[model samples]
Structure formats: structure tokens, C-alpha cells
Target chain A: MGLLLTEDEKMLQESAAGFFADKAPVSQIRALRDDRDATGYSKELWLEMSEMGFTGVLVDAENGGFDMGFMAAGLIAEQMGKNLSASPFLSSSVLAATALKMAGDKQAAKLLPEIVSGKMVMALAVDEGGKHNPDAIQMTASPSGNGFKLNGKKSMVVDGHMADQIIVVAQTDDGLTLFVVPTDAKGLDTERTIMVDSRNAARMVFEDVEVTGEQVLGEVGKGADILNTVLNAGRAVLAAEMLGAASQVFQTTNDYLKERKQFGKIIGEFQALQHRMAHLYCELELARTSVLTALTALDKNPKSAGPFVSMAKAKLGSVAKLAALESVQLHGGMGMTDELDIGLYLKRIRVAQELLGDADYHIAQITK
Target chain B: MSDLEQFRAETCAWLGANCPEEMRTPMKRETDGCWGGRNWVFQSEAQKLWLERMAAKGWTAPSWPKQYGGAGLSRAEDKILKQEMKRINARPPLLSFGIWMLGPALLKFGTEAQKMRFLPEICRGEIRWCQGYSEPNAGSDLASLATKCEDKGDHFLVNGSKVWTSYADEADWIFCLVRTDNTGKKHHGISFILFDMETEGVSTKPIKLISGRSPFCETFFENVKVPKENLVGERDKGWTIAKYLLTHEREMIGDSGNLKPVAQMVAELGIIPDAALQAKITELTIDEWAFSQTMSRMLAEAKAGASLGAKSSMLKYYGTELNKRRYEVMMDAAGYDGLEWESERSNDGELARLWLRTKGNSIEGGTSEIQLNIIAKHILELPGT
Candidate 1:
């Protein structure tokens, strides 16, 4: 019932923070982007992360995971966000692992260990349009002999470019169903789309991509529950990351305010800027609690965590947007330049805000 | 079962048996809840009975020491009691400044004699207290307050006026800040003292606000006598105590965010507002959720021994501002009806009056600007100009 992390959770958070700071600071993003890295993230770094058991934060012990929970996973995600670290931890670890565990089919049980070990990368392709509307998915999974034939296009599929397998959401005769399809499956086309944040995604078009009944993540039409569970988990974890990013941006801006002088005094001395920072600090505190509560709720009971997840996502989305905008505005000229890490944060926050669900989307979800 | 669980069961059963059915419903008006005093009259017998029964069990001031007529419950137990009370939608037995503001100060700074005299009465809701801190000359710059208190051998003669003394005319006593000396810093000469509002020279004039209500008053004390034992804490060191009491005040004000959500209020009115207004209400609802969680986290952290010093300012600022916004949306939802003033059907324009009252929320305790300044300078460590 408490929002503050337990002692063990705090220790995990601190260690994760240290790991991200040392191994994958924001400079890592700059390097990968400059090098035009094929994977858009480092595999070796992800392997090390797996060794640290971050990749297994949500997987069960039977599947060779830490079996910690969403709170642990969120803590790791938050650190990754602080460092602007690029990885498929969200796609392969949180999203796919949650979907698989919830499905608990033979294929899921077989793939769970691989995901936990970082030996297999999986991506959940849920969005079929420019905007995120999971329920409006029009991709068809028609009947085929002992299997289904998929026909659809999914845009903005996270880690889709490098995934060993892709969990595709398509409409069946009953309703929406999720299919675990290999990237190399026939009639599947994957085109890497490098987002402004320098993260990896793909425009995926599936034409007559056949998959057996065993490949279905859950029962046909019953996939809505599993899909929602995966989406909510992603939303809550993304909120935690956004919280960390917003906090770091605030710290950086506050530092600049102290160091930068105007009218013969530090700009932080100006009441105008100071009040704005104070207001943002208040918002960040609220967002922090929202994110923490959401993650805790998800760990405690995923079914009832919907409203909490929406609150966290919406609150953090708006707050992070403010933080990014304020960081740029406060930094003045340097903020506009890509040379400073502030712009990188701005781009990444924008991308994350749009991912899973944006403020408006989540607000609609909550109000409806 | 654990001790707390057993205590909770007993408490729930006791409340169900003792709390009157009339008292289980929300207070229809501010006075519907008992604010006990020498001259006070109860609105209903249930109100009086509710106060008496709760006070008899020393549950009115649950966390205070048992010797001081409190139940002496642990924080966990007290929380459970509050939860149980809230579960039944039971109205608070008593609401008084004596319990909220003055009792804490007395417990911390009062001598055993002072504690013995005031604490029991406070716990029993026998005395209603008003604050005498702000003056017309001192609003946010409260240290410059110029209430005179001259020592006259065995007693002190007080002569001064306090503005924004809420419910001063109805209060039985006052916890006042008077200037005992004027030689040192403005903050240094102040002394905290208590006196009966029924003293010959003490008088209060109600001050009408925009809401057309006079919850506040201008309280005057002209050459009033007070015993030397009336003063709490060291002479000329009332500033520290004043600051400490203000933290509690801010926390109390910030907890106002715990009110029913705006959307639910709107829904109760049977008005599904336009899309734009609905969006505003939704945003407010989400913010309220976040703010509630933050309040819980802050309280838990404070209980865990974290200093909530300047952080209280952050809460006060956001909570009050959020409350103001909540009312604005509420008024917007009410539309033309919100403009109704002094009408019987509108409950004497309760919504409009409350909306206007929320405007003072950001102004009272400390102005939102003052809170921001404190947060910026203390919490954020921004440089002073």
C-alpha cells in the first residue's frame, strides 16, 4: 500500500542506476546514432544486462528469470531512460515476456527461457497505424488448414528490425488474436524505421504469413486480455522511464540555472525561472509517485492496474513534455543544438510519450 | 489476528454501535458538525452525542498521550480508525483550531501545568481556539507583526489587533503572537501566548469576503491582562514555534486535495459536460490521483523519519492550486446555476461560495508565491537575488 520502494527494491534501483551510468550513458546513444549501428543498440551491453538479471525481471523462476516483478523491471527501465540507453529490454524483456507468460502456450514456454537469457529478441507489433489504437487493429488472421494466414501491416513496431520473432496482433473471426511469427517467416517484410530518438522500429507488412495453432499466444479472440496486460505493463514501465528522464532534465536545468549568469547574477536568482523550476519540481514529485504506484499495482494485480497505469502514463507524458520543453527554453541557444544532450532527451521523450499511449490517448482511456 | 487487526475489529464494531445514524451521513453544513465551546450550541442532539461518545473514548485526539485524554493509539491504529470512520461516511465529531493548531504547540512547548490545563479540554472539544498571528500590517512578512505585550510586574498587558483570525468571534480562547520586545530583530521580539477571548478588552468584528460569508474576523485586544504562565516556550523565541506550527498548518491545508474527485462531483450533478469541459475534468482527475499518491508517499516518508520541512511548501502550493482549479471546473460544470448567489435551492450558493473560498486557499496559510519562494530557495537551493 506504500508508494516508497522497499529496502531491497531501493538496493536494486541503486545498482541499476550505477550500471546504466557506467556502461551506457547518453554518449552511448550519440555513438550508436553516429555509427549508424545496424541494431540501434549494443548486443554486448544487453548480454551484460541479462547477466545482471534485469532481462528476467518479469519472467518466472521456472523459465530461468529473476521472477522479481514489474517494480524491479520498472526500476531498471528508469535507469536506462536516465542514461538514454538503447536496448530491447522493453520489447524483448517486458512486453514479450509478459505476453508469453500470460499466454502460457507451448511456444511461450519454449521461448520464455530464450528471452530470459537474451538469446532471443522478440517484438510486439500492436500498432497498425500512425497512432496507437490496439482495439482498432484491422489486420486479418483468417482460417487456414490447421493454422491461420495473417495479412496486415504494423508500423512503429519496437525492436522489429532486429527481432528473432515478432508477436503480431491481428483480427480473427472471433476477435483480435496474437500470433508469434518468426521474422524470417515467408511473406513477412521488415523495413527498419529509425525514429527521431535513434531507437529501432520497423514497418512490418504480413501477406499470407501462415502460423500454426500452437503459435497463437492465447486463445483466438481471448487475446484481448493478454494484449491489455502487456500494454498496461509497457505503459507503466515507460512511465517510470519518463519519470527518470524528466528528473534528470530537471537536475540538468537546475544546474545550468545556478551556473549561468544574467544581469550580473545567476539566472537561478531570478524569481521567474526559480518559480518555474519549483513548479516543475512539484509536478515531477507527483509524477514519481504516480509511476511508482502504477508499477506496484501492476506487480500486485495486473487486472486492476488499468486506471493506475493510465494515470501514470498520462501524468508522466505531460510532465516529461514540460520538462523537455522547459529544458530547451531554459537552455536558450544551446538547447536547439544537437551538440548538447538536452535535444537528445527532448527527442527521446517525445518518442516515448507517443509510444504505448500518449497523454491524450490515456486521458481518453481514463475518462471513458 | 495481530494487535492492530483486533483493534480495528473492535473499533469498527464500537463505531457501528455508538455512532448515531444521523452522524453517519455527511454534514449538511459547516455548523452541522460540533465545534464545542462555552457559548456554542449544537445543531442537533446527534451532533452533540457523536462528539460526546467519541470524546469519552479519548478518540477525538487519538494520537495524543492517554494522560492528556487521548486514546494513545499508534499511527497504524489511528489510521485504521480514520479508515473505519470514513468507511461509514461518518461526520467528524468535532472540528476546532484547538485540536488542529494549538494542541500540538501546547503538547510540544507547554509546561506540565499548561498541558494539564489545556490538553484535556482540547481532547474533549470543550474549548474552541482561534489563531492570532497575522495583522493588517503583516501578511506574508509575518515577522513584522506589531501586537504589543508589555510586562506589568506579575502580569502582561496586551494591546493589538489580529486580522484573518478565522471564527474568532465564536472561539472560546486564542493562541496569540504578541511583540514582547522591540529591540532585536523583528522575529526575535515575538512571544507566543494564550488568553481567553472572553476577556473584557477582547472583541471581534466579522470580515465579509467575496463569498458573502464571514468565516474570518478582525480580533482586537486592548490593554488585556494575561497571567505570566500563559506564555508558551521561551520569550522572544516564538518564531521557531510559529514556523513549526505552520508546517502542520500547511500539511492540513494540503490534505484538502483528498476531497471527492471533480468528475464524480460533476457526474452527481447529472451534467455530462461538453467535450472540452470533460477533458479538463479528466485531466484534473488524473492530476488529483497523482497528487493523492504523492501525499500518501510524503506522509509515509515523513513517518519513516524523513524531514518534510520545505517539501510541505511544495505540497501546499500544488494542493491549493489544484483545489482552486477543481472549483473552477466545478463552476464551469454548474454553468448558469453557478452564478446563483444567496438562493435557497442552491444551498445558499454553496458551490459558488465554495469556489470563491478555494480562491483564499492559495492565499491563506501562506500565499502560493510565498510557498514557491520557499521551495525555490530551500528545496531547490536557488540563489537569492
Candidate 2:
């Protein structure tokens, strides 16, 4: 596979770009943040996204999905990032759908259509602490009647408060296990955690919540492999999103450099600023290739995609951070005001950098 | 198999049968590879044989037209040949400025007589060429070169000197930028010309680098007469050619980012890196991978007929930075042994010396700062003061 997008992929990317720009621009996120919308993202936009066939990008044709693959999904993610559109695309469509598809059981088969129809939302509750350390899960799952009882706290559960169901990672006698528990189940509590980026996430506390045998995803103790597949897919697509956001930030900053005048000349005329922008451009280019390589590997060669995914996440994390900081600094005093979109991007990029796996986390993984 | 696959299979078979065992090994040193010239000596009989075999098939200059001593392979075919050769770990048959720098300019702007005369020898590796673009005062500001070329009724009288002319003392010929008129912008009134290094009043002196090696020289000419036919392209319009050649030069330097990875070097040296050192190596490894992908994407796009233009500056800047960081990590991984100077165990302090030499990577082929400026002004279209 090549680094460039094919004709069909480009067309898909263009359509996604047009849809997001026309329907849910950055102003949508601003409105959500100002109103403190209980759902965090617009339900109408999510339905439109499903209608656009974005939610089922990875599902098979038998399940009524586009079956277009992860590259197509990544292109849509990138457009969403550029527009700063809020949705459960990552949490439900990419992460939950991939987990279900990989599980390939009766439960997954039943849930796939619900996700595609936008009738149900799902969240992958992996992280237990402040940072992403999936292997260090302290949650426990014990036998309860014919099923299992889960007792643990899952932090940073993307769209957990809004999800109809949550995929919980808990420790079992065999090892790590995955259980799909309904959000309305007894003794399960989900508290919405409003993030600075104005995105939705929740802290879920499960106290003796019971799940049936059918709720278990894949074989018990073999959940690590499935979880890894799900996480890597998420990391690769998230990296694409970050790349798009960083590119837009750079473009906006560059345009401002040409128009904003200081000391009787455009600030862009300054060699210092020019050099910084140029370096950021180089970094964005490198990060773009990293993201594309990882997504292509995921679509074409899934078995060997671990290191590529880590590299893309790490590279894009650092580059997107730089892009945000430079945008703020180059925009001068106006950048600090809430009225400008630069601050919004800075906050969002900060959240994205720490979301699945930060640069340091991924770098450690690469060396390991 | 399709036509390209058929070509690949044939090419693979041909390389397997033709490339010698000794020639399949990597060069131990830069000088171990053949760079054919009038006064050159072969490092080994295998080197001579490989050059002859490849040149005979006109594969030495794979994509050039057959009339100019090449196989006239399409870009795809040439890429396949390279991939096949790399599969065998084969060394390049010949390495010369004549092939990389001068040949492309000649192909684009040379007259019929010039092409017929110079292109064949370049393909056959009969002459080694050195670039004579930079003078003492005209490095980054090459357009301000004062290397005067006086017009005469029968010939051109050239004076002044060029510094940092790589391998000038060993080269048989020089493609130089000469000042033909002093009236217009500094970029104007320049002429690109070629002349024999052994001409009367021509001389060179090797300049030693921090690596304790002398791969570059200062070349001087005092009233050296060049034939009228030696000029390439229009007089006073050589800046365009100079700019074009610089792009190729930048690309060549950027390609140096493909150096053997630092982690592999540490592994070969049998060093077990600690946690911190391992992290540094891993970071470098990832950066290297990202840089390589960028390089390949740029090349593929260029092959698809997209103009690289200012993007080459980005490649040159990032590639050199990545290479420099790789060496730094290498030195850290090497520890005290990396400080070795003048020792056989260290290959005469090869790693240390090469590490020191990487200092020039960001400085040469237009400094990284200059590349940034070009990217800003051209690619980003940043305004000027």
C-alpha cells in the first residue's frame, strides 16, 4: 500500500470533509461547551453520521455496514478532527465495533446491527486510572450464579455516560476478561466527566454488577489479544484525527501570519516565526506519513501493525502538541482569549495527546 | 505475470547470475567502491568486473536514453532494477558526480554535440567530475560568485577559485559557475561551464575536515583557457541550472538519512543498553522510520510527476536532523569507547570521526536554516520584511 490516498479514498475523504464543514463545524463544539449539553454531542449529527454510512465503515456487508475498512474510517476521523466535531464515532463505531467484530460471537452479531442503525451506543472502558495502563487493571470479576459479578472503577470511559452499554475490562480467575454490561444494570454508576476539550467521557463505578455468560466477549483470559486489536485500531485512527487537527491549526496560523500586521508589517514577515512554521510543517508531513502507514498496515496487514500504530500515535501526539502551542504563541494576545478558536484547538489537542496512549507511553511500548 | 513482473523476474535472475560474490558485500569504507576516472585505480578485480558488466548492459545509467549509453528503462523498470540489486546487497558499480550531479543537468540543457561527447563517458565511468559552484565568498550566497570568466574572440579566460570543491584534487573535470558579466542582479550574468582540471594554470589543494580526512579541496584557476564549446546553456542564465542542480544535491544529501540505524549498530557492538539509553535509541528508531516513510512518499510522488520544488527542503532539513540525532544516540550508547581516536580496534576512530562529520550535514547543501527560509518563503508563502 502507498502513503497517498487512492481515488476512491480521496472521494470519501472529500465527502466527509464537506459533511462536517456543512453540518458540524468547530462552532458546534463551542455551542455544546457553552450550553453544557448533557449528551456532550448532538444526537442529530450522530444520526446523520450513521446515515452517511460512517458508523458502519468497518462492519461486514452481512451486518448492513459499508465494510469499507479502517483506512476509510480514519479518513472520516481526520475530517471530524479538522472540524472539531463531537460524536461517539471513535467510542462506538471504531472501538466498540472493532471489538465486537473481532470477538465474532452471537453477542457481537446482535450488537453490530444496533450500532449501525444508531439505535445503540457503546463505550470501551479500559483505563482504570488517570493514565492509560490497560494491563494494570485492578477491576475484578467473580462467579455470581450462572454469570459473573464485576466490581471496579473505570476512568476516562469515552461516552460512558451516554453509552447504552459498556465493555468492561476486569480481572478473572483465568486472567483479564471482557464483559459487556448494560449501563442501566443494578449497582453500576456513570458520572459524566466534562473534559477541557468539551468532549464526553465518564467515570464508571461498578459494584457487584452481574453480567450473563452471553455478555462475555471472546474467550475468558484471551481478552488481551482482542483488547490489543481494539486499542491499536483506535490508536491508528486517533492519530489520523490528530494529524488532521494539527494540519488545520497550522493552516489557520499560517493564514493569520499573512493577514495580521504588527509594527507596520505582517508578523509572518519575521524570519523567526517563519522558521518555526516551516519546522512545524515538516513535522506535520512526517506525522502524516506515520498515520497513513499505520492505517494502511491495519487495513492490509493487521498482524504486524503494533509498532506502526505506536509510532503513529507517538509522532502525532508530539507534533499535534507542537502545532497547538505554536498556533497560540503565533497568534499573540488574541490566542489566549476564549473568543478565538486557537485556544479551543489547544485544549482539544491536549486531551487527544493524553487520550489512548501519550507519546511517552507509546515510546516505551516501541522499545519494549 | 504481467510485463512489469516479467521484467522483475528477468532482472532478478540476471542480477543473481551476473553480480559477483565479492561485489555482493557492502563496502567497508567509502573508498572501497569504484569511482572510475582517468587516474583511478580499482580497489579489486571484482570492482572492475562489476563496472564493466553493468556498463556493457548500459544499466549503469539505467534510465538515460540508449543513444546516450543507457538502457532506456522506464522509471518503474529502473526502480525494479534498484530493488533487485538491493536484494542481493550489491554495491553500486560506479559512484561519481558525473552520474548524480552533472548528468541530469546535461540531459535537460546540453546540446546534441555535448550530450554525445560527455554522456557516454559518464555512463561508462571513464571520467570523475567535481562541482565548482562555491567560492571563498560565495557559499550560501552562491549567486555572488566572483569567479570571473572573460570573453575572448576564440576562448574564455577564467580566473579566481572554488572552495569546498569535493574531491577536486582527484577529479578529472569540473562543472563550474563563472561570472560572465557584472551589470545585472547577482543572480544574473552567470555561466555554467566545464573544463579539464589538468588545464594550464589549474591547481588544487586538499582541505582537511574535522574527521581527519581530506575529501574536499580548494581549486584555483589563473587565466586558464576554456574552449568556447565548453559552456552549457545560455551565458548569464546559468542560475536556473544552478538552482536545478542544487535540488538534486539536496536530495542526495537528504538520502544520507538511510544510514544504518543506531539500534542495529548497538546490537552489532554487543552493547546492552540501559533503560534511558534504550528509550533514546527507540525514539531515534521511530523518528528514522518516519523520516524514511516521508522520503519514500516524496520519491513516489515525484515519480508520479509531482514537482518536489520546496518540499525537498523539508526532506533535507528533517533527514539531516534525524541523522544527527542518530549519531548522538550512537555516541551515548558507545560510552567511553566512542571517544576513541586513532585506533585500529575502532577502525581509526571511525564512529567518532563520522559522528563529528555529521556536524556538516545540517550546514552543507544549504544550511538547515536556509532550507527553513526557503520552505517559509516558497511553500508557506510567508511574507518578507
Candidate 3:
């Protein structure tokens, strides 16, 4: 499956859609909002999903995975978007696996196989502050007597609670550094945080955690270099996923309009309603095109992916947010209900948007 | 390479190897038609040769269906062919409204007989089409036009004056809007009609411009008989057809934006290459990229079967403005040469004609003001003027 998916992908997406509809429905997500310890999604279905290659989508076939690259892995996320499925793929594969690839170390490579097997959980603990911007780093990493002592809180860590390993971002005297700390390591504290999306993220406290000097993921002070490249790829995948999510919101609202009647006719029959739907549809398609072009451009000009990456993030991020908001507003009172699937989309969109730099942040970076 | 990739590579190689050699120039090279716009003189052998070759290959209408004399390539394939053609610096097969506007309309709304008849001829470069729109008073308020088309039972007698009719004097045929009902509201009475330019009562006088080019014409039709079969769609419903045709026309103008801006190209390929000029070129390329994305999105959305109503106006407005900006830059790149009106001394003939003639781009088809109103009413839901 490439920029335009093949027919088999459409069928695969349909099958995934069927699984989500039958098992981990919206009600399950709704019930998990207040339960501090409640992690939603069915484990049996997750195993089934893992069997379907949801776990190691971009992993090499040699690692007991499908070697479909970002494009195919991206489509699954997009379809997962259809139901606002709160899977760990975004945190583990797109973020952590991406960082590992950047480090290109023997340890990171060895960890990939384990991570892909769905037997291990991992997270890239970047973003020292609430900001997703790399420039926001204030965490300190300094040489201790034998190795290194890391001190700083990594805020808004996805899977930070359940992650077996946290790839923490810290600043050294040289520059920004990324360190892989085992979640069980002493002096590390993880506290659960509530998210609008019902997915659990955590605020992590790292107080003088000692690690070997070799525990750093890549070359010292070069974490920003890897972050930019990984984020570029992330931006494209995020765009594809957002496109998928926005598409569902558009569809759900459309379905509701068709089902609910006003003035003795379907509200969709009104020209005013039709034009608003049409305009939003146009924006979604435009965002989709920008994403496809960005991906194609990335394949061609791997060197200049920075601007295009930011462009995709800037365009698709704001557009997806708008799609979610508009879908709810257009749906009227029922759209905001926890029962409807549209609310799930809005919830997930808000969180994922903040996961990356928010729209305005990315847009400001894009002005260059 | 995969078969499709191999096919694409081979196709590009072939186009690169076969594009006409002598026609490649940074200077003004004449076409079969020379006088520009209304008085266009077909004088260049290379232009004629290029057109015949492309039309025969069906590359002229790549996205169009093969049954209607098009290449009928898939969207991806069509995009590849277009990129290859650009890489080869191929001059357009035909830049006429016939290929871009009327042909697409005929394919969509034309009777099967019309498609079988006109599309092949259009594809083969056997027809020359000119738009018969715009009038002195009806320039921006196009729907308020008072041109008359009386139904004479056997045929419709068209009598009116169309101003700024590009290439009306040189064109073989004209597609126009004329009033078939006078008493109804201004917009409802108008009907879109097509007729032969050589009809006895039809004549055109060139409207010369400061650029020594005549892109506009004053067309007068007196009792010109157009066959009833030439009536596109319904008579009173011509507004619908005209509006639909306008979308295709706006899109046509928008799609034309994929070309490198004349000034940008000159800055890169002309005798003078400088850093400041190259920066401008980068800017234009970005605009072109954004515009290309917009047009591509339109096609993709349509293919995906989503209804995209009225956004064509937005495309038209941005595109026409971009085109004007492109031409302005072309004039800037031309420097002192832009002031030279004599065709014999023209630096880049196409560039010269384009720079001067493109002034009407914002004015032609639908005016920029009309587009603003469209966006206001149809898109923004603003109160009517």
C-alpha cells in the first residue's frame, strides 16, 4: 500500500473496522475516562490485532513483522483513526522505534525485535516540558562519578506508565541528549494523568537516576538531529492518520444528518447544510493532497524534509482539529455525547494534536 | 524496476529522446498562428508539427477517456506523463479553449454524436475555438447581458455584440451566451450557444492593444443562424450548462498554472541568471506547487466521488491572480525588451505574447469581481448585493 492504497488494503481496512466495531467499541472508551487505573481496549482483540501485524507493522520481516515501511503502517493508524482507537503504536513505533533507528546502535537494534514481538512495551520520553518543541529541553544530563546522573521531569509521556523503557530527553553541557532508562530504574517516578482522549499518559519524575555513559541513545548533543529526521517521518504518518480520522468524523456527521430529520426532511437536504459539508470536505481533501505531495517530495528530496514536514504538520494538524470541531458542531447536541463515535474522534484529535507540537507551534516553525 | 515504474521510465526516456530539437529556444519562435489572440496568425511550422504529433498520441488529453479520443490513463499514469512532458520541455499540444474547456464540456454534456464528432477533431487539432464572452456593460455582470438569440423554429437567430472575444477573428467557431427570453429575470433568460464564426452575418474587428498584440476583438453577430442541435443542454437551462462549463473553464485556467512562470523560467534559462532573480523563481515555484496541489486535490476529490460545488470560484480567483503575477514577473525579467512591441524583435515570442496577453486573464472567463461575489454568496453565505 502506497500513497494510494491497493484494493487488498481496502479489504484489510474493512476487516480492521469490523474488529473494532465488534470488540473495543466507543462505550469501552467512555467507561475508562474516570477509572484512574482503567486501561481500555480488549486484550484478546489486541493479541488478534498483533497477529494481524499491528504490533510490528514497520518492523522487518526478519524480526517477526511486516516490512511495509511508514506508508502501510500509516494506513492502519488512519483506519484506527476511524474509531479513535487508543493504541500504543503512536508512542512505541512512530516515536520510540523511530528514535532507535536514529541511534542505530546494536542495543537499539536488539530491542527492536523484542518491541516488535508485542512482548515488550516502550516509549520515547521526549518533551521535557509540556511543549513538544525540541527547543523546550531543560532536563540536565551530567557525568557522575562512574556514569551519568539524569534529572528532569518528562511531561505528557504516552505509555509512560506501562512502558518497560523510557527514552528520556535531557540537556547536557554540550547540548540535547536522549537517554534510555528502564522504567524500574531507581529515582524515576511515573504518575498517571487523565487525557481528553481517555488514553493514559503520564508525568514522569527523574531525580538523579544513574545510568552508564553508554546508555545515551545516539551521539551526545546530537539528539536534536535525530529528532528532526524522525519527526519529519512522524509528521507525514501523523498527517495520514489525521486525514483518516477527519474522514471518519466527516462520515459520522454525514450519517447523522441523513438519519436525523428536521423540517420534515433530512437536514442534509438544506442547501445551507450541504454547502458547509461541502466546504469542510474540500478542506479535508486539500489537506490530504498536501500530505501525499509531502510524502512524495520526501521520497525524492530526503534532505529537505524539514520544511515539508512542518508544512504537513501545520496544514494537516489544524485541518484535522477543525474537522473534529466542525463535525461536533454540525452534529448538534448529539455530537458531544460520549455515546457517539464523533466525540471519540474529537477527544483523540485533541490529545494527538498536543502530542506533536500543536497546530500554531508547527505553523510558526513553517513560516521559515 | 516494477512494470509500472519501468513503463514510466521508458515513456519518459522516449519523450526526452523525441521532443522537437529546433523548436527549443529562449527567444520568440513563431507558431502557425502569429498575430496573437484575436488576429492570431498560424505561421510557424514547428507549432503545427508539435500539435499534430501530441494530438495523435492522445497526450493532448491524457486524463480524458480513450473512447472519446483521449489517452485514458489512470490518474497516477497521467501525472507521470505530464511530469515527463514537462521534463522534456515539450511545447503544449494545443493551448486552445477547444481542448481544455469545450472538449471536456462536450465529453460530459455533449450528445454521443457530439462527442464522436467533435472530440476526435479537437483531439486531432482540426478545430480552433474562441470564447465569445464579455461585453462593454456586461463585463463583470455577465449574467445581466442583453444579447438576443431568437428561436426561428428551424434555428436560433443570434444577434449581439461580444467584446473582448479572444481570437474571434481567427477562430473557426465561437461558443457564446445570448438571451433567449427577455422578460424573465436577467440571469434566467440567457442561453449558451455555439455557432460557426464564418457565418454570413458574423464578423469580427480586432481590438488592438498597447502591446501591439490584439487579444481582444469586437464580435458582431446579425441574424446568425445556429442549428438547434448546437444548443448545449436545455434552452432556458443554458445557465446551468454555462455555470458548469465555467467550472471547467476556471479549472482549466487553474490547471494551466502548473507551467513554470514565464519570468521564473527566463530567470533560470535565459541569458541572464542572478541570485535575486533565482529567489523570485523559488517563490514562484512554491506558488506553483501550492496551486498544483489545489488543482490535484480538486481532481482527486471528484474522483473520490465527493461533491465539490462552488470551490471552483476560489480556484479561479487565486489562479487568475497567480497568472497575472507570473506575467508581471515575465515582464520584469524581460526588462527593456518588454517595451518592444515589434514581433520581429521580440526576445521570447511566447513570453512576449504571454506577458502582454495575460492581462486579460483576470478579466476573461469570469472576472475577478464576479468570483469575489461568488465566494461571498455561495461560500461565505453573505447577503446578496
Q: What is the DockQ of each candidate?
A: 0.85, 0.90, 0.09
Candidate 1 lDDT by residue in tens digits, B1-385: 9999899999999999999999998766665668898887888888889899999999999988999989888888988999999999988888978888888888888999999999999988989999999999999999999999999999999998999999998999999999999999898989999999988899999999998899999999999999999999998899888988898898889885448889888998889888889889999998888898898888888864334899999889999999999999999999998889878989989989889999999999999999999999998999998
In candidate 1, how many Å is residue A214 off? 3.0
Q: For residues B75-116, write the lDDT of model 2, one tens digit per residue.
A: 889989998998899999999899889998999999999999
Name the lDDT value of residue A213 in candidate 3.
Answer: 76
Tens digit of per-residue lDDT, candidate 3, span B238-285:
777677778877766655545655544675536473555544544554
Q: For candidate 2, what is the total of clashing residue pairs?
A: 0
Stretch of 10 with least lDDT, candidate 1 chain A: A1-10
Candidate 1 Cα RMSD after full superposition onto the native fold (Å): 1.4
Worst 10 residues of 3 chain B by lDDT: B29-38
Candidate 2 versus the native: TM-score?
0.99
**lDDT of every model, 2 decimals:** 0.92, 0.91, 0.71
Per-residue accuracy of model 1 over A1-368 as CA lDDT, tens digit each: 74978999999999999999999999999999999999999899999998999999998998898889999989999998899999999999999999999998788779999998899999999998889998789999999999999998999999999999999998999998999999999999999999999998999999999999988987998989999999999999899899889889899999999999878889999999999999999999999999899998998899999999998999999999999999999999989998999999999999999999899999889878
Q: Candidate 3: how close is chain B to the reference, as a TM-score?
A: 0.83
Error of 1 at A196 (Å): 1.0
Least lDDT summed over 10 consecutive residues: which range in candidate 2 chain B? B299-308
Which scores greater on lDDT, model 2 or model 3?
2
